[model samples]
Target: MIESHNTKGLIFNVQYYSIHDGPGIRTTVFMKGCPLKCLWCQNPESQRLQREIFFELEKCTGCGICVQACSEGAIELFEGRSRTNRKKCSGTGRCAEVCPVEARKIMGRSVTAKEVFEEVARDALFYQRSGGGVTLSGGEPLAQPRFAVSVLKLCKDAGIHTTVDTCGYASWDTVQQVLSYADLVLYDFKHIDPAEHKRYTGVSNELILDNARKIYHELAIPMLARVPIIPTYNDSADNIKATTQFISSELGKNIKVHLLPYHRLGETKYERLEKMDLAVLIEPPAEEQMLALQEIVQSFGLEAVLGG
Candidate 1:
């Protein structure tokens, strides 16, 4: 039945030697389709629910191979150039199939739990040496909760240290299932204020906060709360204080809060995906801004650290 229905997780990449995700030298499996759309998202290509193809216009070399490969006549060539009619195209990856230069990328691919585990466990020697295993990152892994849980359990059963990097925008059931097997949970705490969060990330944070508290109390797992320090969204001195206060008092020592500076890598993805450019609205926060923010939050008698 599983093979008949083609049930599989859509993964973008399996990154090796990743140090920032969890403990030392981990393999990060980036699953696609996120529930939230934060403006400053570093991995915008992972947002869509379905597979997407990115065409690098500069690398095209005006090649018409993709135009000829389309069976639906979805691709068009004009003025010595190739263009995909967004309305006519289905994003079925025909264009990507013929682009030999790797300029065309199908953003997501369906892979079985066994396939993913094999790739992850290939780095078993590295994991054993460095105390790292696999970290499941977004889009949002819980968006495909069943697949995420299955992979986590397989890793844990194999005696591999497992970490789940999530936005915490999933249902309590989904969160609980994955947490049942995860060793460390890197939870993203975007914003505290619901209205502000909605304005920035296109989602409310009520459930996110509730889930975080549940993880602290019910799950009681070792977790690190990450706050992306976007200017005008959640970087105010007052907001950081409020966030750290709640994290320290309510969440306990099992959790620590780290604030990250906003970045612009997602802007190019915005252009590629024909989405709006949010980078123009704000700049990356200054170093002094980070120090001040850290000081204010640490003054709350918490062990707040930087650099993940």
Candidate 2:
């Protein structure tokens, strides 16, 4: 793919000085949009392509300020409780703009590549000092391939290291476009079996597995396959062994894998986003369980990391 000089991406967050995402202290750019609907997704807010409203019940004063501010009458106060009619709401952010307590927040915004690069450049000194740069994360950065590549190009021009944290579900062409600018890739490996993968993530694993191989072999991109260990979903010894075998034998190596233990940090977001029905909240595995899984990877003669 050719470089797009002025592509715009829908971004939700620009987190600075992060040590976990890449090689060193780095900034993580959270872009919006993803193909898979993983049951245990941590960033529920980043799943959609368009901007979304987050309603916090505790912060709401029930003053009806947002109700009046909403031109579409999407917000209403009932029994001193504020509710949003998601169907009526157009995500214009007008209600959020008028909310007194920030109870209503619009999550995503359209940002030009140049603008995003400027924000990342503010941390250039830290990147140089810590051998860290910028990490493109998301709902799957490859979902917005053009915008992703554009920002990556800016990072390349600035001599900053780039890492792409992806689900590896996009087309091979799209992967090639963005991989051109990425120095390291963080690939999410949810399940080895296609049936189990589709059961939890709502998509076939064929595309994802195929893309992983293309990244490692065909494209020759260095990538770390990370797994989110969900209890009863993918934490079994058999699952772990299967994943390690695939990473070690099929996927090109360094044979490095990161085990991301599931946590309930984003559980409340389900209610805020009114998506509890879609969420599969479960207790995280014990530290010992994680350690055991790590050892399983090591048993395969592959380097295993506890966290990403």
> lDDT of each prediction vs. the true structure?
0.81, 0.89
What clash pairs does model 1 have? none
Off by over 4 Å in 2: none
Compute the lDDT for candidate 2.
0.89
lDDT of 2 by residue, 1-308 (tens): 65566788899999987988989899999999999988888889999899889988888889998988889988888778798887887789998899889888898999998899999999899999899999999988999998999999999899999999998998888888889899999988899899999998899888988888888887787788889999988899999999889888898548588999998988888778867787775999999999999999999888999987
lDDT score of residue 123 within candidate 1: 90
Give a tens-digit lDDT track for model 1, residues 39-135: 7787888987677777676676667899888877877777765777666766689888778886677788888887888889999999999988999
Total clashing pairs in model 1: 0
Q: For model 2, give the 10-residue run with minimal summed lDDT.
A: 1-10
Task: Provide the global lDDT of candidate 1 against the true structure.
Answer: 0.81
Predicted structure with the largest lDDT when compared to the true one: 2
